[model samples]
Target: MPEKVTVSVTDEAVGRIDEVVAALEHGGMHVDQVLRPIGLITGSIDTQRVQALGDVAGVAAVERQRTVQLPPPDSDVQ
Candidate 1:
């Protein structure tokens, strides 16, 4: 599983994320070229800067970290 991260959202940032979602669903994810939401959620950067990108109106998702338990690596399959 991928690590979770938090991203701050502004009114401006979310607009762009919506566009990207649309593109990903139809235009083959081209919106990823300049601004992408993954960077924010992945903790590579802050959401404020994302909003500064202009095209994005606001941020949508901000995943919070959570704890989970599972079998350790190298364990035999059930």
Candidate 2:
């Protein structure tokens, strides 16, 4: 199944990140958020096709998004 992922771009490649985002969106991929200040992007894409993003000019890393579960406040675990 397709899943959410976070994409980070190299500092030197900042200008081209937007172009990559546009191309992904144009290809029917869902781009949920664009964090330009940190050069990051969050979105959902087909797991099988994730490697395609690596081929984009500026992408430094692609990571799968995972949710963290925190214990209730009263729990002993810290």
Candidate 3:
């Protein structure tokens, strides 16, 4: 299964996140969403592509997006 990840771009590459996304798209990766100001790109990438995505010039970090379960509303710990 492909994993969803949030990619952070380098300060110098902030405005060029699209270029990174374009490169990934050429490899059949999906570019779901992007935040230009923060240089964040969210996409669903195959395991094999994860490394390659990070290797893109503008990309600083690529971290897998994960879900965390929360306690029930009635739980004691606040």
Candidate 4:
């Protein structure tokens, strides 16, 4: 299954985010957003390819996106 992930670019690579995005795509990442100001790239990729994303140049870290579910406003679990 494809899992969403947030890729953090290294400080030194902030200016070259575009290149990093290209490399990530080449590595099987289906990019959704490129937050240039924060040097973060959000996207989804096969679980198997996550490790490869970490190896891409300029990538500081690769973290899986976590999902949180909430009950309705009137729910007892509130």
Candidate 5:
């Protein structure tokens, strides 16, 4: 399964986000969004490939995306 992830670009790499994105893609990431101002790249990749993303030159961190589900407004659990 493809796991969604958030890749944080190193401070030194923020100016070269495009290159970072390219490297990530080369590392098997399916690019989704490039939040340049924040130096973050969001994407999905095979779970096994996630560790490879962290080894990319410009990557400072790679974290799997997590989701939180909430019940309806009327639900007892708030």
Candidate 6:
């Protein structure tokens, strides 16, 4: 079975992330290996309407996080 997902990104600046590495960029020197990226944001998403999101603009150089399923409270019992 395929996993169901609803992902979307808003073309807006929310905030910047901390940096942890130094690297050269085409434009100039940047904190290349940024632990996180700048201007990461989120908004409403509909997996069914993915086709309509082709024109959505995503932030630059930021990595998007994926949904993860955590074990139930009692799962620590194994």
Q: What is the lDDT of candidate 5?
A: 0.94
Question: What digit string (tens of lDDT, one per residue) describes model 4 on residues 1-78?
Answer: 999999999999999999999999999999999999999999999998898999999999999999998888998983
Select the stronger candidate by TM-score from 4 and 6.
4
What's each prediction's TM-score? 0.25, 0.74, 0.78, 0.89, 0.88, 0.29
Candidate 4 segments exceeding 4 Å error: 71-78
Query: lDDT (0-100) at residue 55 of candidate 6?
Result: 34
Pairs that clash in candidate 2:
none
* Weakest 10 consecutive residues of candidate 3 by summed lDDT: 20-29
lDDT of 6: 0.31
Q: Model 5, residue 53: what's the lDDT? A: 89
Q: Which ten residues in a row have the lowest lDDT in candidate 2?
A: 20-29
How well does candidate 5 score on lDDT at residue 70?
Answer: 88
Model 5, span 1-78: residue lDDT tens:
999999999999999999999989988899999999999999899998898888999899999999898899999995
Cα lDDT, model 5, residue 23: 89
Number of the top TM-score candidate:
4
Model 1: per-residue Cα lDDT over 1-78, one tens digit each: 233344444546554655544432242222323335443423322333332233433445544446687877878955
User: Over all chains combined, what TM-score does candidate 2 have?
Assistant: 0.74
Candidate 2: which stretches are off by over 4 Å?
A: 69-78
Evaluate model 6: give its TM-score.
0.29
lDDT top scorer: 4
lDDT of 3 by residue, 2-76 (tens): 988888889998877778778767865688998888888888978777777777778789898888999999999
